[model samples]
Target: MTTWLITAEETVIADGAAPHRQIEIIRKVHGNKTREEALVELHKAAKSHVPDSLKGTSRVVGRDSDGSCWILPKNGKGHPPCVIRFVEQIHP
Candidate 1:
């Protein structure tokens, strides 16, 4: 189970940190996605404009309940997971 320390973004620059996001993750998208592929994937999946800005910052990912990594469409309007709601980030 991977995790991350969501801290002040400046923490890394201030102190040669051990657990901040690396620049490579931003430039190189998930699944080794090319710029075009990444754009398509993000357009289909992301609700908000995600950070592919090449800015030095952390990236948070999320997966299906079964731990499947994908940037696919929503299951449907009335899903069963609606009973309990929470957001968890998948740390790379």
Candidate 2:
């Protein structure tokens, strides 16, 4: 079986490779399925899954030209941004 893993990550700053950067694995969703089904499921989960870092406050969604997804504070309520991605894995 193949398991699709949706991983969401959060950082103290925008730069992933910044020195003294704080990184956190905020959320992950997984499902076992074929490639086509897993891709659909993982995409849906990525678009809809809320990160643990910003659960209670209001938020907005943004998409970069390079296809990065971001979650931000709706009213500048001090919530940090979150970025997510999905990956496919195979298992016996």
Candidate 3:
């Protein structure tokens, strides 16, 4: 089994829009699956697993291997409200 750390980070942007949250596979290890497979599983969990308090605004959905992220309204699609880019990846 792979150990994965899915992080939901919330931030306030300069656009005056509502606060946003992004989810990513911040740390993944010990799995034989490809990076894509790991991400797919992580995204599925994220879709319905947000905490109650953060559910109102956090819409994290997609993440690239490079760690870029996107958010959208529940049940909506295309054109994210904003992007939560990766600051850095820590491999320790």
Rank by lDDT (best first): 2, 3, 1
Top candidate, metric TM-score: 2
Deviation of model 1 at 36, angstroms: 0.5
Clashes per candidate, residues 3 or more apart or on different chains: 0, 0, 0
lDDT of 2 at 60: 78
**Residue 85: error of model 1 in Å?**
24
Model 2, stretches more than 4 Å misplaced? 12-39, 65-68, 90-92
Query: How does residue 87 of candidate 2 score in lDDT?
Result: 61
Rank by TM-score (best first): 2, 3, 1
The candidate scoring highest on lDDT is 2
Q: Taking the tens digit of each residue's C-alpha lDDT, what string does model 2 give over 1-92?
A: 44556556675534465633344433343545665565455456556767766788777766655444667777876666776655654455
Each model's Cα RMSD: 16.8, 5.3, 6.6
The number of clashing residue pairs in model 1 is 0
| Model 2's TM-score against the true structure | 0.52
Model 3 lDDT at residue 17 = 82
**For model 1, what is the C-alpha lDDT against the true structure?**
0.30
